[model samples]
Target chain A: MVSAGAGQAVDEGADSDPVIRVRGLENRFGSDIVHHRLDLDVRRGEILGVVGGSGTGKSVLMRSILGLLRPTGGRIEVFGQHLRDADDVREIMSHRAGVLFQDGALFSSLTVLENVELPLKTHRQDISTQLRRDLARSKIQLSGLPDSSSAKMPSDLSGGMRKRVALARALILEPELLFLDEPTAGLDPIGAAEFDGLLHALHRALGFTVFLITHDLDTLYAICDRVAVIAERKILAAATLRDIEDLDHEWIREYFHGPRARAVRDQTSPPG
Target chain B: MSDPAQMTEGRKDDNEADLVWERGTEGLLLATGDWVLDNVELLSDRVDALAGLASGLDASGISRLDASGALLLERLFHRTGQGPTAAGLRQQWRTLFEAVDFACDDTHEPAPASEAPWRQILERMGRSTVEVVHSTHELLGFLGITVHRLLRTVVQPRRLRLTSTVYHMERTGLDAVPLLILLSSLVGAVVAFLGATVLRNFGAELFVIDLVTFAFVREFGALLTAILLAGRTASAFCAQIGMMKLREEIDAIRTLGLDEIEVLVLPRLIALLITLPLLAFVATISGLFGGLIVSVVSLDINLVMFLDRVEQTVTLKHYLVGMIKAPMFAAVIALIGCLEGLRVSGTAQSLGEHTTLAVVRSLTMVIVLNALAAVYFMELGW
Candidate 1:
């Protein structure tokens, strides 16, 4: 089961074509292997939450798929196009997918409006400056940021507002797929809940396929339709929260039935 | 989800985005093709040309629509002062249009007006004058604090950061020895050669030895070492401390009830203070060796005689004059580096600006202080 192929997880779940598929993924740093034969399939229009303990290579896996880090060995197909054979891998990937990094990597020197407009300036140079600004502003508003936050620099905004700006920049192109890394980390409970609500609403309205990596159990429960647990350098199981909770694995049991998870679960479920 | 499939289908070949206006009977605007970000420019221009004629719009023919495309539609509606009817649109495109409409509803307020250019120039000059004065005040205050802590540490030797001081000494002092020796020796040889050429014309070639000794002992040795340290060690100190400040490590130290000055600045100051004078001593010796080699080879001066002349002319008075300036230069360089580092604000751009400022200030201050000391020593007849 520890070495189960990612194809197996797809066979056992909802019957939808994969948007992002990884097979025989291997990542190694010097002699230390981070992932070995890891496989995953992100289905269309599903919020697939990827979770693991610290140093379990969750970020590494995401980076490999995004082409930020080239894996030592793997076959990756995004939008049914093989990454290695594509003439312009980044061009093919970037136009279709949007990424929200963990720390809201906004440019420190630019105002929020300029940060959001950057992608349009890069990919769609034919768009008039006026239309580009309006589209960026609309996306910012759609991400639930206030009107005042548009003119301020990233350094001037609070952490939560900065994440919203990053999200706006990511969603500017109206990409069909979204990759979110720890979207709710470094936020207070209320702020995290608000962010989760915003993300869920955006996902439903946009209907983009979401590959979300998070450690916040609340985020998983609130938005994710299925959860993929990375362990032993492969996905041990990929299923709904209830099915994952019922699995008799030690880490899964401790993770799902832990005190924190219990508190979140009780709060989420309807009263008996 | 249904729209994305239709989107891929529309993008396959000749189904590119298009907008047409019928100025005939109904004056209908029929939008067709994939209306997404990729085709926004062509779409926006077409929509603008027909904005006034859009009495009735039919969007059912459009193959695909995204938020950006929705924004363009909303803009057209706003320009014509008419609300979007959404009468014949697909369900998904209708949802997208409504969402874009609601989100982009608010109009932007115009930016505040600016002052005239002439008035702005005058205001900027006056502001910079005040800023210069304020910075001078801060520099003096920081110097006072550093001196106060040094005196306190002198009284209680146990308070010194011995480990940190030694570590910095190895980095800023020991590692820089070879580069210092090479530069000093090269400059000394050049001076000796120049002196021999000029002095030989006057039939006083022997005086070249005096020129080499005076130049290296009183000016070149100390000044060169200080300038080199100003460029090298000061920039290093500024960058390292500026990064730590950027990461809030300085604030962390303070929150833990530790004096950041004692933990960070004092060690660098003490290391530079102790090592600069020693480096100057080495520079002076190597410079003299360079002069000796030139005299024996080019000037045909007797080796024993050269040694005797150097021995007699190298008085402690001249040596003291140069050696005394090293620690003063060291203090200025270290303080400016640390001060600029601590002044770094939150952004990476600010850190870079501060690092450059640290090097420029330290280098300028070193040269200015050396010039002042030269005038003072001459007045005192040292």
Candidate 2:
């Protein structure tokens, strides 16, 4: 896997063409500001990792980015297009920016192949049934599973395998931007690390932009080129992990300098 | 040490100051800068999001839970809290909370248990218990909102046109036939046998054909078939969709822009519609065949004589009325199953609860609809 910041490019166009720019974004469920005035810039082809404390609203920020949550008071510009209207959301989704939900969100009645085919067939109007099935077949293979998995329902797969299948579904339209929400939340450290490696491999291979909302520092350091911490209804820093370390907020520092952070630091740190 | 009027005046002044202070920052932000009211000032915004999610949502229309609180908290702490003064308390409290470190309402910091008064602790516990019940009732209100939404979807002038008769025929009609045939045949045989034993005393066993056909068409076949489908298929639909909803798969579909009822419920409704008429057909034939067997063995009436008597006694009209009642029974079953499935939320227990309710409601609706169809058809005459 590539080291953090190793994936940096000299391309200024992507930086200027920020795929999503959130300003003063806030979310609430009745009376709670889940995130308060969160501002962030997710550039095209940039793997921006969102990290935070348990209740800091990492997923909420992702929701706001997807226009799932109407940011209480702010702006979200997606692909230089503000997601202020229904049309913007439809436009962005049609561009094949996929979101892999934390629970895998595989429809139970549908077989694994059908789940992967769903997004493709549901969105497209002209693709024939045979073509859809063919695309679904390729997606099953792209997900790194045996052809036998095509007919099998999601209940038959293990958690880790289920995640890979979800990852495959996200890639079915060959998304330009992909959102992986807690891709490795409940996996064992080894499983998480393996998932981390798989994501890095895919990111490097495809060069597709990935916005990951996760708590795993190993994932943030091992794979993500930049980190965005969503808290206080704002993103603390939409910069590299090192830049976030320099941010020095209690929640951020306590996270990176905390026991979990220290462990990743020692492992990634150069020997004296 | 304080004058009472002076203390009261100071407190009122502080309340006004607090209100003023809040208005300057947090209150202003909360009032307008909030998510839904900001630039998204239209009711169409949520509908717009649902449209976005319609392409994204699974068949159940539930949305994914936002699961990133800790990361949000980390950012909150990092962005805004360092001063140590009366002025900083607001920022500190705001920063700590914006970080999601603690709930604004949770005042129970770990004061020593021995220092705490027992009466206060009991009173707090009692208050919390009441709050739990209050929330539970509010949860039902949320469910009512969901039900209202479902009714709105169903009551539209065009109604959705979800059920395809051909698709329904395959799933419901063919699969349900054998069981209905078996059940009706046994009931028919029992009725004929009971008739034969009594009719032997008078040597007038010819009326058994009339008894079996009339009873099967009027009462037994319609209700029995309804109960069977209600138990077997309707409950299964509720459980299946409910589980997908609980898994957030339905939300995933909605976010993806597919209509849930169109994808999940329509085909099943069609299947029931197709199946019910076919099942009624089988029930009538099997019941007649069973009575024919009883006639040959017990009443010394041959199959030919029994058929002739049935033709004379029970015409095409009775069977026609029975067959026509099928689609209404199917609609009632489908409506109940879909409604109960849509009611599902939260957990596995909720799925089980909805499934049981689907069965009960389907059975009730089936019986009521069958009775109504029978009455209306009879009112019109052959």
Candidate 3:
């Protein structure tokens, strides 16, 4: 199913509209500059993998696009609506977007089911309680979590399961745009692969545009439709993996042609 | 109205995409506009109402269709047991809808039934009782380890954390001096004024000096200072330790092969031991001074006469009794605070709960120990 959709998305790439348009993005912390004149476009229905070395501010860019941080200079347009100038656009974007933070960020006090139900309760206040529970339960199952995990605390779950619960919570709203920050960072090899597969399956099922920040080369190879590299205080390149790997830059050369990248490429089939 | 141009023209008036049902011979359901997550809620009720009636679903006019919208259509088709007819959904959207249909088939089982309220309460009570016993055991073990480490450090002075001890003494003791002095003075003056007013009725106004001296020196000074420190320093200790535990710094110390008791608990305990006695002495002096001032101002007794009366009526045993309880109170306060801190688990709520528990436990223990000491001293004819 994912292969079929991936082919279709690639075929339709030329005519697809840009869902997220970022231009002249700048982020600064006093004397420290994180991003400067960064520009990137996330097309509709594509998984855009964001990668950078440590301290390169990939997460900051995601935060700025998500409206969590006000960039020092940038104009961000999501779904053809400017984020900063319009309140209605922001509200619509929020309803349409979901973010899975690193560490799951699940409320330690609330059970998994309650965590998944929180967004529904906030956004759809008129839904009946039983209907809300049903929706939340479906989302949890959709994330491949067992029904038994619904009542358990976040602290009780393993790191992978916690990430699944966070995914369920993020998807509870049936969002059209999903932001994932290092979705498989701390998982073991098998768990990371399973998570990647789950993410691919969900994206195929949901058709949501994904903006994923990751350091894992395998994730970029296995799932991303296009990879964006950040370096030297700006987005160095944003292209298909084939194009990104062939880029002529010092850090890009070492990163994409490195032993780890070679291992990842050798392990996985070439991108479609 | 049947013309496709007219239908497209009508959609321009409504900015939001919607599912429109036609009950004519075609019996068609028309999906128009952007069918995305933002508008799925708007379409859900209408889709549910018309799903059973429509013979065919058409999406020829849809400008956009995302996973959420596709999922809704899949759910509608699943419920009505009808495949979409002439929908003309984009290839990507059709694949997504198919996936949703395949995935949503396995619904989750119902959650387990909750336990009865009375049973839950009883179970919680039993668990808490066990937890209390375990915590007490842990506290005693920690106290023993702390004492052992202190003894070892005393024998080998280089091993002692002298700098940390002095820093804590300045924080918990010296910083507390003004508040302690002020509180003891006010309480002493209040006691003396109250005693003199009552004793004047019996023409024994001069006896107020003896009353003030005895109570302040024997009970009020030590007890009040202990209670105040328990509320103030003990809660601070709990918060500091709880934060460290939450940050895993305590775990780091353990992994580094350093004794947590020696590093964390011993410095605090020793600082309290040194400070509490000194604070107690200061409390006794300030309290007596308060009493002397009250006697001089209110009773018109000269300073020398008030001192002479206190010397004649109150014995050195009273001062000794007050000072003797200081170290014990200090140990209890420090132990309870540090114990509660070590008990902290993950979460800010846990830190807050342990801090409150620290203050309450220390205050209660100090009062109970003071009463027990008073009884013992009384029996010993002190």
Candidate 4:
């Protein structure tokens, strides 16, 4: 870990605070400011999906929270502790924050067993190899992947399978804070829906906060406790899908009750 | 925590759901930007973390880089170095982090490199071409390593292993046999035929047996095989690893707290070191086979006579000299291949270029080492 640097923020939220706070967050490169004093929070145990158009700074914000990107100003306190920028925070947040990368980020060299076992290996060093395998297998099965999927590489697995494998890795750690960068961004309707189902099950099973970033409308409606419509470098509003439907924000009205949103929502709508 | 006056700012003008949403989004931006600005101290921290993490292919017994960059960086960090290795560089990196304006929770990709000129870019390559390649610095790294390791092991005792010795032997040594044999055999057969023709007028064509043995075993055969393996295996290792680097696999490993040398380069270095000598030995045998073909035919020297002559002309010293060349050649080739591979950055095109450079550098290094071995052997009058 590198030495502590400047720009430490003043605000510190409490443990079990439920809300993640952001203050005076500004991201810029040269003269361009992508985020200007943006602020938002995902309450504990809520599935918060962030929706945005291309280049709307949705993923950037997600990366920032995950500490993947250093903020250009501001503070990110997770479960009420300051996470200084360093290379080793992944180990610190080991089982606390699970991330499902866009490409699934599963190692090409590793089989599914090995990939899911990665986080488990980092945290629980005492488990037998067979126990680790069993844990990974269970995570894979919990991810809704078929039995045949456990041995596959990221390349060997289908796109949906890759996403599931990523989800499996995320779940393997049983993190309290989950970040998914476009979990169903590239999947087909059926594939995407199934993936969304897996997310619902994961949230229910883990009782964790899901910081979900996506462009998928149906997924937002299906799983997100509050969908934050990211547009113009700001969160349009973070609210439940039902609240989003009634919102007066121009994009919100058009986005939620919009024809496109309605068409996607109708298909995946659960039985009345 | 909800203030009515702030609510009137229209920013606070929202329900808990909206307030919660807005705060989460806006706060994220603030926190991330703040973290980076606070960390700008890194720019001044002239200590490149990766300096000592590499191994196998790049050790050239040289060290370069003036502390001039340190002077410039110190100004940024507001520090004066007590000495070159003082903690000034790291302190500057921290203090500089204090100055940047960071987005709370944003890490947008900066605009394309072409759009940003110097004085605007923080990219490491933002300096000059030489600054980016660090060629002189890297070439000189052998000294840095020797000194650094010497100090470290003494301060805290450590064990060193040439364990990768076997791996390089396999990848570079074993895998190189078929090609080295094929190429050297052809060279020997062609040389034998041509030598026999030239000697015919003297009515001493059978002496071509001596020519073949001396030529293949003592000199060119082993060198040629080394060059070929350097081109094929060494270059391939560089390009492959370089591409993986560009893809952020290197960063991923580092983030996971793994050493790049032990995890990636050592295995390759081991493969090359172990394999090259084996390949060289094979090349000499194959070249002799090719020479025997001509001795049996064009030179009118029977197989038995040719064998006798080769046995006579080539001594244990000749075999030992070539074998000696193989491991050194292996080390050089592996080192150069790995060096060029790690040097690759940017697009897929850079990977190709680095691969080519790896091959070229390895071949050049192999030739240089071969020459050194030759001179050393000649000095011994063997």
Best by lDDT: 1
**TM-score for every candidate vs. truth?**
0.88, 0.44, 0.81, 0.43
Q: Tens digits of per-residue lDDT for model 2 on A70-183?
A: 667778887777787767887887555888999798887788878987876776645556445644554555455665677778877888888988987887666778999999
lDDT of 1 at A201: 81
Name the candidate, 2 or 3, with the larger DockQ value: 3
Displacement of residue A41 (Cα, Å) in model 1 is 1.0
lDDT of 3 by residue, A1-272 (tens): 01111122222245336889888888999999999888788888899999989999999998888877888998888888888744645696668888899989999889999999999888888766755776677677678787678899997899999999999899878777899999999999899999999999989777789999999998999999988888888777777888777767778889999999999898886556
Model 1 chain B worst lDDT window (10 residues): B1-10
* TM-score between model 1 and native: 0.88
Clashing pairs in 3: A206-B67
Question: Model 3, B1-382: lDDT tens per residue?
Answer: 3533233234445557877776564777777777765666666666666677677777767777655566567766665556644466666566666655555554424567899999999999999999889877887897788788889998998987989999999999999999999999988899999998899999998888888888888998889889989999999999999999999999999999998888888899999999999998888888888888898887989998987887787777777898899999999999999989988997788899999999988998899999999999999998
Ranking by lDDT: 1, 3, 2, 4
**For every model in order, what is the number of clashing pairs?**
0, 48, 1, 73
Q: Stretches of candidate 1 above 4 Å error?
A: A1-11, A14-16, A85-88, A147-151, B1-14, B85-87, B107-131, B194-207, B239-258, B345-352
Total backbone clashes of candidate 1, pairs 3 or more residues apart or in separate chains: 0
Predicted candidate 1 versus true structure: per-residue lDDT over A11-83, tens digit per residue: 3654446898888899999998999888788888899999989999999999888888888998888888878
- Give lDDT tens digits, candidate 4, residues A57-113: 887887777777888887766777666775545654665787888978888779887
Task: Give the C-alpha lDDT of model 2.
Answer: 0.65
* Sort by TM-score, top down from the best: 1, 3, 2, 4
- List runs of model 2 lying over 4 Å from the truth: A1-14, A128-131, A270-272, B1-382
Model 2, B1-382: lDDT tens per residue?
A: 3321122123232112110112233311011111111111121122222222111111111111010111122222222232112122223123323322221112112211333588879989999899659744653564454445457656872544444545556556677777878888998999898877787788778888888888787666766788888998888778777888888878987999976766566666666766777787778788888888888987788888887887787767887777767777777787667667777987566798789988986787678777777788768875
